[model samples]
Target chain A: MASDGHPSRGLPRSIRNAGWYLLLSVLSVAVLYPVWMTIVRALSEPFVYINEGQPFLPVAIDWGVFNTAWAEGVMGRSMLLTLGVTAIITIAQLVTSMLAAYAFAYLRFPFKTVLFVLLIATLLLPIEVTLIANIRTIRELDWLNSIQGLSAPFLASAFGIFLLRQGFMGVPSELRDAARLDGFGHIAFLRKVALPVNRPIVGSFVLITALGAWNNYLWPRAAVTEQRWETIQVALRSISVSRPERFNVGVAAAIIASVPILVLLIVFQKQIIRGLTAGAVKG
Target chain B: MSLSASAPIQAPTRRRRSSRVREALLGYSLLAPAFIVLGVFGYYPLYRLVHFALYRPNRFGNGEVYVGPSNISSVLADEEFLDGLWISVKYLLYTVPTGLVIGMLLALLSHRRLRGIKVFQAIFSSTVATSVAVASVVFFGLVNPKIGKFGDVSFISLAKADSALRGVALTSIWQNVGLTFVIVLAGLQAVPDAVIEAARVDGFGPLRRLFRVTLPLISPTLLFLIVILMIFGFQSFAPMEILTHGGPAGATETLVFKIFQRRAPGQISEGSVMALGLFGLTFVVTLLQLTILNKRVHYGE
Candidate 1:
């Protein structure tokens, strides 16, 4: 469908294409405007984002708003807490999902189809539907305002099982048989053979889960009242809402909160997109 | 672990039966942890939803009393709940088409083979990296009329009683546009070349090809995106929670927000009822879209 590379292209077509390009450039700027303004205000003078007279271009820059924001708000601790929670959830989900995925993909069990359907059925049940119920469960377990509350409900991902099962099913049975003949039990085969063979899917799942856990706000908001248990996003929102005077610091906190995932995006661009589109296909 | 019990079960197909039992044992062991977690967090909530919806917690020192299905009507008749549902519909109307059109437009623009197109694509999809909470706060800060561009304009948040929802809806569109863009771009790329070539040979203009041949062929992707976006829009909470906090006088208090706001024992029944109502709405709409759209999608069959 793309036929514009050749020099034989007419001037009319070129001008039209240039028009499209300009529109795209302008729209991109508009799309990036909110983020740009936030980052500029964040790194620039504090509260300049709120002032009526502050220029679009920052006049004076304060590079330490991040430090100040982190120090003042529960941001630093929140970030560390979020990282810890994401790590716990990621590791727990990976292990559990991998095990379950192996069972679904390779093994035959009684009521296997029924169990699989039940798991997939949960995909339709968004957490919003069950937030109250889950909160009650967390309270009952005395896991509220703690790391377990933050990560327990997310320890098993139905999406992970579905994604990895596709990968495992792609594994040729001959290879599995050979590994089995070598006395590689399920765990042994999974680690040495299956995981390596399905590294991309595994990597994608890890990044997606990390991103989800890092960005989770609703559950954390519902389950945790203590500031000690707040994730960075939730903490940032509380700061912005309860204290609008600290808008700049809230922006700073946002910059800090998104930094790790931004780094991840830059590093693992293709894997993130793969994970996203995998979700689209599943939907 | 239960091999001893399995060993005692003699059958005509003894060998096959024994391996079946052993595999079942292994499978159950592997699945137990995930299943337990799912049961507690996933299925249990659904069960509790029905239970919670059927009872009303008394306002006095007394506990919850069985109210049968009355909670459903109470929740449905709640002024905030109804407003919330209305705002959610408005949100879906506002965000979905805007996002879909912007995404489709950008996809068509980027589908052209031009130099430095990847840079433009990256810029278009950059917002995909941001979380809902982050984007909401950024917009929240920027919506101040004093310094920020969006704030300078009165139409953003001060347009009317329902303007807060509009403001939050703008953020949702901004944040979710990248997702729609990426999905639609993939759809465009997957669009077969033969049809486009045939359209070109048939003397169709660029715009005509886009409106007729391309969009029709890519309607499946568009339909999938619409369904997902509808679900996202109906279920949107974090944006409203962070940006509007269910108001400038609760204008943006969508259903999820109402569900969240109703936390007291007196309101928990309504919350559960609203949650169940929303769950049913989302479930039905999703199934409806999938069934309706799947038949009409041009699969190049």
Candidate 2:
């Protein structure tokens, strides 16, 4: 124990033990309010229900309105587009990061120290710093309104490389040498050894990257101006901005926008937190 | 703990020239694909921003007019940039402490040995699902002037010029408090049970145990949260753009938002300069954090 364990010198234990439970229950309601309302209004009829009974409650649920919102907002197309783009970015970044990390951890090269230092230093460079020039570059390539534009700038990440490198380097060199003696090439070793051992890191990084892509607001909005190429984030913004009258539809769009990632978070909360904090705690 | 073992002892492989060449080749090849992508996006864009900031590119991406570093000075003097900086500071003030305090409160409240405690923890952390855009839109709907949930339609803070920032603050806090909660919960969990029990044995009261023991023990995580929250807060833009479009006036525009929201065509250089300034700000803040908080943050045995 690092600290003195003396509980009796604090506030009355009886009051704390009794009151905390009630305080937590009440606090839960406050925290859940916006999310609950979003789902409720998303399910309710758009224009008519706002004017009618139980103004805030989710009674008179209507799937028809959500269906109409999906069609009208082109949310289905945009959602699919976002999903495909997210998947590509996630998978590509992982493969690329894995390769780069393996090199850093196991292979020898000239200026290896300099290269690693530079890459790590780049972690401090915020994406916003380069957004201006990058968007212009995207424009010059005629990549706007395309998956290439959406996925290109993010196909590699310093953060990903740094993370995978930490995990790969943590692996025992003895195990690696033994594998090589048994005729495992780098590719085979990575697939069988590195990937398998660091599955938590890989899994968590996938979730984080997927979340980033799904929630992309600025780049997607700025890069792809065409309505056809718009992601759901852009679509949701335009929907809410254009048709506050269609409030329920707007809420439905937001809900539909968030569901997949929400499921991922619920299922992989531990790994996601691990992935997020990996750089923070140790780096 | 496993980190101590990573000092590479070169395997007893052949050290001949051919083998060395092959090893180097393989290393570079592995690094090549990612380096190419990073070159195009990360390093290349950073280089271009510096170049762009030094010169004014014409309407076409082809020609350039060199204006030198005066562009940065001009941007610094500009009112919008200064206003954006102020807004950024205000956002940090509102969202950062509130999120930390609320999160710690949630953590402490649930750190009990109760039944189904995880259910409450999960609910508390559930807002992590709402992305910036999604959360901003949700808050927008909630506080919309008419048909809005909270304030009377006419008195909606989001619709007013002076109070729109506060409205955005609520959205930011709602989205971020979950993250703080999770981080703090992890920190609290890491505190050794023996420490708590020892405090009880020493006649430490409930609040004393918390103040003199648990909070101090968990301060490292809290400090870590502060660094992240400061960075995240300074970089906030999506809520401003999504919720208020940077205002009922320009009331909610923060530094990152200012970097992208151009009022004129030649403002790319200006925005680039501001972006770099924001980067400098981020680096300085991080340095400040490490120097200031390093003394107090506990590294447990």
Candidate 3:
């Protein structure tokens, strides 16, 4: 058996490979079929689609629905608004987390251990747990339907601090000594050395934070009472639910709402995966 | 020279002491922004939630009435709250294992050393793009009794009280498949090829190698996935909100949905109680996984 090219109790190598490929291909189709159907349904004329018994393929193509959904749903405003909120949250998380992580990883100060513990403790009280009170707080501050209410509660993330501290701790002590000897202060060292060395971790955190902020539903749904303040996710809901007669328009809105994040995922696929598994897979 | 050296050393000691104070100041300043935000928004609300649970707003709408721990007991005894908890548990049962198995299968399939495997991996993980809102809409359309692809499937009939949860669960499973697949695949990739090769040399078949060798090696990752998926299961709201609206009867009304419904002005106390109950449930489950299950997880030396 060792003398032959084939292994023990095995078919030819090509056949085995083919079998695996076939299985993988089938699974991929199963995974992708729903999304493809959605795309078809969104692009097809509803009457023709129903007339054709909702065949998998589009019977009559309509480019106008995308425009209609965009206008009717006020999706453009929501997209821009959501993008602004996402940017604010992402940038704020990065800055705050970096500052906190730097202190935890590199600085020595009073109550440092206590503060780190306090930060981690926030994880236990997710937004769901504190939603009723937070809404009151937002109302008391007169921040309802405002970006402040939308972005403030999430501006700082304990998970971000934890992830970043892990990354920064991996920065070599020798490098820190070298930076100090060169007359670099803490901020200078952080900007020039620590962040650059931990680019991938930072990148992962940024992508995930942006994704989370963009797709946020519950908070935005509760925070904003006005149609103008609605995020894309909430707006899509109104579009779909408010006009059940124009189902294709709703589907088109969903597709539009998803396209930006889909493009981000494709472009930064590696960073997204790394971010998601950062906790499970140690560096 | 001795006097000069002593003077210099004493002066440097004073300078070093002052510098330590400066360093502490800088560190505190760096930590201030995050702490303030977390305190006001994150920690304070937690305190307020507890306060709200124990006190209800009086009829004047200005002052609170001290109700003590009565709210907790009342909420606990409520049939709807209990039903919500049960539904949440059912949801957990429906989503977690199914997600784990599908994720595991997809990972194993794509973990092969074959050409164009990355393409398949991308397709498999593509659902990570679909948010809760998008997924709810997609599945809502998919499961519609008249226009849906699965309209004729008896088991997934949304109009039936008993089977509606299954429909919502199907949406959750599909939406979560990408995340589970990505994490599990990462775990599988982390397994060294040399170990698998050695298992083969020991005459271990693929299935035996997977169960006995590979699975044990990746048990830590599996545990992580399970905990995460469980938390996700409990947090699920959008699917129920959009697809079923807790429908036909109240079969799909998970705890989060119930909490959302209790958000009305008069029901804040009750909602706070329910919210705390949810927190307690999540806390206990997570602690169990980390404490008991963690003992069985394999961490290679």
Candidate 2 per-residue lDDT, tens place, A1-283, comes to 2232226436676665556668778999999988888778777765655455326577668888667778889988999999999999999999999988988887777878887867766656666766777788898898989999988888888889988997898777787777766878777888888889999989999898999888887788778878999988888888776677777888787887888888899888899887766533432
DockQ of each: 0.50, 0.47, 0.48
Q: Give the candidates in order of DockQ, highest first.
A: 1, 3, 2
The TM-score-based order of candidates, best leading, equals 3, 1, 2
Give me the candidate number with maximum DockQ: 1
> Can you tell me which runs of candidate 2 are displaced by over 4 Å?
A1-18, A45-54, A279-283, B1-15, B57-62, B151-156, B263-265, B286-301
lDDT, residue B159, candidate 1: 34
Worst 10 residues of 1 chain A by lDDT: A1-10
TM-scores for every candidate against the unseen true structure: 0.91, 0.90, 0.94
Q: What is the TM-score of chain B alone in each candidate?
A: 0.88, 0.88, 0.91
Residue B6, candidate 3: alpha-carbon lDDT: 12
Error of 1 at B262 (Å): 1.5
Angstrom error at residue A4, model 3? 18
Candidate 1 vs candidate 3: the DockQ winner is 1
| Candidate 1 vs candidate 3, lDDT winner | 3
Model-by-model lDDT, in order?
0.79, 0.79, 0.84
List the candidate 3 regions with Cα displacement exceeding 4 Å: A1-6, A48-53, B1-12, B288-301
Question: By summed lDDT, which 10 consecutive residues of candidate 1 chain B come out lowest?
Answer: B1-10
